[model samples]
Target: MLSSVAAPSALLPGASPVPVHEASAERDRQWWRSSVIYQIYPRSFRDLHGDGIGDLPGITAEIPALAELDIDAIWLSPFYKSPQKDAGYDVADYCSVDPIFGTLEDFDALVATAKKHGIRVIVDLVPNHCSDQHALFQAALAAPENSPARDMFIFRDGTGENGENPPNNWQSHFGGPAWTRITNPDGTPGQWYLHLFDSTQPDFNWDNPAVHQEFERILRFWLDRGVGGFRVDVAHALIKKSGLPDWGGRADGASIEGFPGHEAPMFGQAGIHDIYRSWRKILEDYDGDRVLCAEATIDPLDRLTDWVRSDEMHQAFNFAYLHHPWDAGDLRSTIEASLKAFDKVGAPTTWVLSNHDVVRHVSRFGLTGGHARSGDGLGPEDNQPDHVLGQARARAASLLMLGLPGGVYLYQGEELGLPDHTALDHGHRQDPTFHRTNGERLGRDGCRVPLPWTADAPSFGFSSTGKAWLPQPEEWRGLARNLQALEPASTLSLYRTALRLRRELSLGHGSLAWWPEYDAEGVVAFLNNGVLVVMNMGTSSVELPAGELLVSSAPEAGRDGFLAPDTAVWLRLA
Candidate 1:
């Protein structure tokens, strides 16, 4: 599906579309209300210790670079102690930093340094489950059946003549059965425990009071360390339906809406809201408008809003907008629905284009031009990505995302316009997803490859000892941060400029109104804080709205009146 773009076919511009509204005064609220938070996948960011892995200290060393980008906060992926199973998603300890990542002292220093630079830190919280090596889980494993330690997790009796089968038909998010049979101390077949993800990560029984109390203590422990908020991992999967029902053989375990089993008993249960409500209270007790942002994939955009209610989470990642195809109509519909839904609960909408889990949008937008479908970890056997085309579209997509009202998150390497390492070798793969699916689904390691800092430096300067946990491709040398910083037109420069203007124009904290001037099949135009944003997603160049050009994602600003296809521009209206 990675093909060349079609020739442009110009179409006559029609009358005004939706009317623009005046800018609102909401920009003066808390920093989070309109903040732009950059997500840092700790493992792939940088490695200062030269141990071939990124650490908290390495991230602290990069704070000045992040500050220069004008971001208000940083959402760090899990850095807690873990067994490295599921790439740190399987946490062994919530209160301490992993030895590989750093110690608690290193974490304290990082937070202190980040605070000095006026950047807030939002930590990733894995409340749904913990690694089997965790103290609580270990105690549960050794304790007798029905002990309080075991009660904290979802351990249940198995079915079948010899009790060899799992408790239910639920599937793991990584692929395969969700339940793993455990053995008793007597060396006999025993009960099974649920793990929505990898087998090493056991799902906590949220129904248990001890589980709730433990999480509350975990929240306070981090809050005491000065974290501004949390990015809740698998926020929807924490609370499952009371009955562990059959999944009906559907494979899309992450999604709760589609497939034959629409109401999957594993995730997006109604009780999840109560958990957020309690966490929200903990955040309020601390200073600063500490927030909770959910990584929820609940469908029907409106229901997704429930996670961001007044008493629940402050923001929920808008995956609907992130997953929308590059078609203008689809994007416009998602934007409209997101605004309307979030507005109902007085919560700011959070927009994100890429994260550690999904295929990078740069490569994603390349295949099929606009309606592409590329899975993560695509190797040599898969269709190659059009990096040039992908980079161009990715730049435009950034401007469009930043210009909208509310918060936005920029993934680690997106500023460098890094496309997924589509040809990663199978032996280097680490995501449990790849193993669980037996290489049938290549996991998310391609996007998680370590960042490139210096073009010619060993390991792209990601590690001083000349090795990276994941190999960096030679093609990435040209896209390194140092090289991009010198090029004014580079994707990094575009993001720096866009983020600066997003604040100067008060776009993030303002209201959005559909531009009434132009409405074409594959074009979307919106006005926020007197700035008119126009994007041409169609095969043809569209007329740019009249205004002084502030910034254009295209190499050159539209001459005469037309914007090139796949380009986006911000116009400062008179």
Candidate 2:
């Protein structure tokens, strides 16, 4: 049984109201296809160490809280040994843990404890590239230009008369030339290597047999250590088009992400599918239901489905849906397109609204209050967000996303309704994109700020030492987890109830049938099994179809069956 829709309750003076949730009924083995996975950007989650940076131990300590959320799995961002150049995306060693994050023992304990709590763990795998300081990259620098170690990366001789120019006119996703010239061992000018992102993070030559073999070993090493799956970072980017041709003005004016630039030679090349097919075999060889989820930014819904066919990866992030504006028509089209495309190959569509790289959806939805951006992301320099309106929309969006028939991903602080720290100072910014663009563009640091856990604790209970790598805004105190947990009308409570009801109703694993007869112009109403999910995206209140009201995103009595604007409700169909 699930909790019923009730009026919003006043917050208790010093108590946190944790909801009681029923366990979901057991289902098929391919649970990854429809499970709700929570993503933890480890650095911003919690810091067990006084050093002010989050660690694996901090994540381990929070497993109980995570288990309370009733999420089926947890996807931890990169915690591998790194130079912090790209904030852990730049992997120095895939098999080892960064000292800052803690020892390998801590990660093992996290996996063990999470399993004990009936939660699966998915680790981030960065096989597309490695930190320039990686052992292989160092060996490449020491070996000769045409040596086998140099072949491990995308190294090529310059093309100009004096070999002074780069191999091509390729530009880095971060900014500047994608190719970086290196000095030879003899201190003479040397060949250049390619890096789609920052120069410190060199790209691997997927064409190289050694690169393929190394990633296979890396995957097996983690799987053997009890990780249930791997979330392949930049999954669509490993295999670039042959000959590295120019983008031909396809670059979207320095934007790092968007559909317009996905067609360029740098992303979604055909060969990437073959790699996933091979990886699928590795996942199958394991005893348990190990899975692979791609962080693919591929476009064309049909092409995106290719990565999730029966023999390829189990799931890929539905980025197109995430980038859709907060309009009913666009949202409906995106949802329909995603479900149709994935259904073609019998793959589950993975719905995600926010992640580590993009602007938080709460802020994105509030863009109309003068925070609009023509691109995928909005920065601190953008107009101020209407927090009240953003929170309303975010709450409604959660119900709509969770009611869909597939897997969903929840970024750490989204359940708290944390908007982007849009007032972050430029000098405190750390994302490589921000520095690479000379601060003209504020990168993703605003969304990556550490979360506030307690309203009165030091560093908002994120760390005991009251230190944080990125500062938390003063406003976060009111939105802290401890405070929200005590408020029945809080966003955190709404998420708790929604996730619990999502499982209790078996809403995650089903087919969606839209009821246009019950839907208004700006409304979306769908039926799944005996449940009807109605969302009012329009300005005015709309009449809901006759059914027993189970829950809603807003706190209001059923007034003549009217659903409030920006509200979503689940009704028990007769």
TM-score of each: 0.94, 0.93
Best by lDDT: 1
The top-ranked prediction according to TM-score is 1
Tell me the lDDT of model 1 at 238: 84
Candidate 2: what lDDT?
0.83
Q: RMSD, model 1, all Cα superposed?
A: 4.2
For candidate 2, give the lDDT of residue 431.
Answer: 86
Q: In model 2, which range of ten residues has the least summed lDDT?
A: 15-24
lDDT of 1 at 307: 89
TM-score of 2: 0.93
lDDT of 1 by residue, 1-574 (tens): 0112222322226643364333346546767768899999998999998899999999999999999889999999999889898888899989999999999999889989999999999999999999999999989988888989889899988888887889888888788988998888899977899998899999999989889999999999999999999999988888778877777644444443345333767777888888888898889999988889898877777778888888999888998888888888889888888888888778888888999988899988887633222345667787777877777788888889999988899899999999999888899999898999888778899999999999989999999888899988889999999999999888898888888888888788887888754555488888787777888888887766455677788667464567888888887654
Candidate 2 lDDT over 134-168, as tens digits, reads 99999999999788999999998899898999988
Backbone collision tally, model 1: 2
Question: Can you list the residue pairs that collide in candidate 1?
Answer: 16-516, 17-516
Residue 173 in candidate 2, Cα distance off native in Å: 1.3
